[model samples]
Target: MTEAKRIPKRSEMDPKYMWDLTPIFESDDEWEKAFQEVKAYITQCQALQGTLGDSAESLLKGLRLQDQVNMKLLKVYVYAHLKKDEDSTNAKYVAYNDRASSLANDIQNALSFVVPEILSIEEDTITQFLQENEDLTLYRHALDEINRQREHVLSASEESIIARAGEVTSAPSNIFSMINNADMKFPRIKDENGEEQELTHGRYVHFMENNSRRVRQDAFEAMYDTYKKQKNTLAATLNASVKKNIFYSRVRRYPSALEASVQKDNVPSKVYEQLIQAIHEYLPVFHRYVALRKKVLELDEHHMYDIYVPLVQEVNMKYSFEEAKDLVLSSLTPLGEEYRDIVNKGYESGWIDVYENEGKRSGAYSSGTYGTPPYILLNYQDNLDNVYTLTHEMGHSLHSYYSRREQPFVYSNYTIFVAEVASTLNEALLTDHLLKTTEDKKRKMYILNHYLDSFRGTVFRQAMFAEFEKIIHEKVERGEALTPDSLSELYYDLNVKYFGPDMKVDEDIALEWARIPHFYYNFYVYKYATGFSAATALSKQILEQGQPAVDRYLQFLKGGSSKYPIDLLKQAGVDMTSPDPVRQALQVFEQTLDEFEALVLDK
Candidate 1:
């Protein structure tokens, strides 16, 4: 077969071909006009605070105006951000993003008093006000959730201090993104054809999928080498982020940073610890998979670089963009006609800005606002992986679409805790669909490899990162400095633990944490593992149990922020607080490994 066509240039595509944002704002001029209005309204919010507790009518009026201001501000912010992310290198777009972000901060600073002042009123009085005002019905859930956290609500002075310190607090994550995306450069690696290719985040996956072992090894080393050289810089950035968490937790009067961070989503620290414990108990399954990899590759030792190579070779399934869309539609039929219809609307409408373009965001995401259609940004190539990613991101878009349609603006946005479930469920269905339909042994093995890799990365690898994040946070909580040596040693030790006794834990791998952007999110990496586990359990329900299971899952999609994340997930038939879902998910992983071993080893 002829070599796959080279990736096309962005300039070759028409600008009009991109996702139409006219529905969001008639034009950039209109967006700017609204931006100015929002800037003026921030001052209006500053004046509404003292009036809030005066009377039910006055409080209702003030709250309604604040809601309007917030919705418009979010729209303006999303428009500027979506535009900038589509072309990060553009100077004008960069300015737009910075201005929008600054305006958001300004709005937050201005509205800081609203919550504190609201909490200061007698709880019974506010409850009476909610009962009295018809217009405030939309905000009842939002108000109740806030009131639930009343004890944690700080004094007005403390709230103002924290609001003003937001930018300084986010400095580490900001610096890390700037350096990693814009400044860091990786070494070149020779491709299968012996042509040197520059390593990029976009190309790293392609290199890792190379049929040539030498190429994969070289690309891995080349990518990590750059990270190794900048290890000190990365270490400092992560250290500051951890310290920020610790400081904020202490100032907020929480016993620990993990508690402070996790409690925001109503997640107990036990949930976090349960995930680690469940995955640790299944370490033997991971080691078995590693051993199978070494056996398949006919190697005495399995290095980290050897992890991604396919167990079955000579299996190529190329998909066009249109074909991928059809597959996504088929895979999602489990979600019911209404759910699938909305997805179809998204496809027919300009919900997706499909295909790669110069200066486009490196990865994929589903982003939109309460008043708009959920929009997706993807750098799609016509491959199996791209098909899965399309399904994945569209899962997010549809979740947002359903939630916004079913709930009010205040409850429209769901927390990240349950965000990945729909996306990965789509993926699981697609995998099962492919395996059941395809008869070719090599293709079957290829599909199985993809499934196993999902578990390996999303399940095992993220758990490892979660463990590292916990260790570093504890260090900071104990008043220990997270220097480069200390961070690297801690990360490297975890790598050794997860990879087991067989694989070689290269020294260069320790610097891996420095390169990961998730570390900047402060105790956020664990969600990937939890999300996949939940998705695995949910997918089983949908396939084996049919409409009843799907109805529960769809209820979860529509729940949004109306309920606590864990409570909402429980409504969907997966109890995240317990370790059963995670353990069951790992069992599925081992079963897949057994199937993969039987197929490849006997052949």
Candidate 2:
């Protein structure tokens, strides 16, 4: 086997092919100019508080000015941060990020008076103001949502303190990223040809895709060993983050940190509980899949590292970037001509920064604000995983594109509760598309394996993370410490519950919690499971019911944050408030497992 060439440095690329930042600002001088303007607007925000209640006209004027300032600030901050995230190692970019974050904190502090002051006004008075003003009609949804949370809304001074302290609260997450990306180093693994390869975030998936079991096990153990060494420090950082949640919850009069975090997005605690219950009820299905893997691999005992090695040894399908684009277009055709056209533009235009360079951010994401095109950053290589990733990010981009086109700026940005749905929906459709078109038996088995792997990772694995997050928070809420030993014990037990009898839940695997960044976003992992469930339902509707389902799903995409996330998903024909969607999704998982089993038997 030939050695893979060293990845090129970012500076070696031609400037023209790089992302055009001029749409955000012409130069650093222009960004600095806007930064100064935003600073001046902070003073303008301070002038609005007392005068807002003087008269209806004064209130309207104050609110409009506040919205204008906020919109401008968003444009400035989002551009700076997105640019910085592309190459975070650059000192100039890091400084830009830090400055923009500080400016955001300052702006939040200055504008904290707006919500409380609005809430202080009599509800009937605000109602009459909305009835009288044409311009305020566009803000009806925004105002109503704020009013709905009137009981939880804080006074201006209190909110200002909280807003200003945002960066300090994010310290744990920031430190985790710094250590995980910049400091952690894994041992080199010997490949199939006995050549040594250094493990990296970009190459981890490639290593997992290797046909050799030894290579996969070496890569896994080498990576986890590094994490195991730093477990104590990571546990401390995570504990600090959990305590921050508890402190905020108590300060805000919420019953618990989980309640406080979930209620912000209008999610019920029952939704979180239901995810755990549904997954627990369906553990048999997961165990069955694991058993099938064990049988196929002929292992006397399946270890944790054995999970990722492909069940089907031969995968012949290879997709170049252009081929992946065409596949995404074909799979998404059910969404209509306009949707397809927008996706085409994302590919043709410079909306995507494709491929990994020396300093590009690891992993994949879809990010943009209301003022810019929804830009996708991907570390693309020619494989099925990259194809799925492209579809997923495009799902987010097109959702943003449609939402911004259809709604006002205030409503264009959707919540995270609904954010993953579009992305996962695309993944579901892409899998269905591949399974339908492929004729060769080996290719069919590969696609089926891919589908099963997605279900396992997104639904099952994330639910495990969710359960761990909930348990740790409850322990903190009950006055228990989050030491490395305590956390590892909790994590190890949960792994035993999730993976069942077929596999060994190893001691070192408990250290896995330290490596996952999502835990920092308290109570956030449950949404991944719920999002996949909702997407499975929506995709089935679009494929089986056709045009009417397509229209409803499109409406949900365009709804953005105009409605509550559950209400928005209800319009798409999935009632996530109930557990039926999750049950149905798990049923689909079972069916896929059955297919894989039969495919293996036939071969």
Q: Which candidate number would show the highest TM-score if scored against the true structure?
A: 2
What do the candidate models score in CA lDDT, each in turn? 0.83, 0.85
lDDT of 1 by residue, 157-199 (tens): 7787788787788789878866776567666667898777667
Model 1, C-alpha of 349: deviation from truth (Å): 2.7
Model 2 spans > 4 angstroms off: 1-7, 13-18
Instruction: Give candidate 2's whole-model lDDT.
Output: 0.85
- TM for every model, in the order presented, reads 0.95, 0.96
Candidate 1 stretches greater than 4 Å from native: 1-17
Candidate 2 per-residue lDDT over residues 1-603, each given as its tens digit: 556455567777555345666777888898899989998998888988777666667777887787677777877887776676666667787688778888888988898888888888888888888777777777788888888788778998898899889889878987887787656766677888898776777787888777787888888888888888898899999999999999899888899998998888898989989999999999999999988989998999888877877778767667988899999999987788988999998877788877776656678888877777788888887888889999999999989998988887778889889988999999999998888898988888888988999989999999999989998999999999999999988898998888989987767788888878889988888898999999999999999999999999999999989999999999899999999999999999999989889989998
Pairs that clash in candidate 2: none
Which predicted model would earn the best lDDT? 2
Model 1 weakest lDDT span, ten residues long: 1-10
Compared with the true structure, model 1 gives a TM-score of 0.95
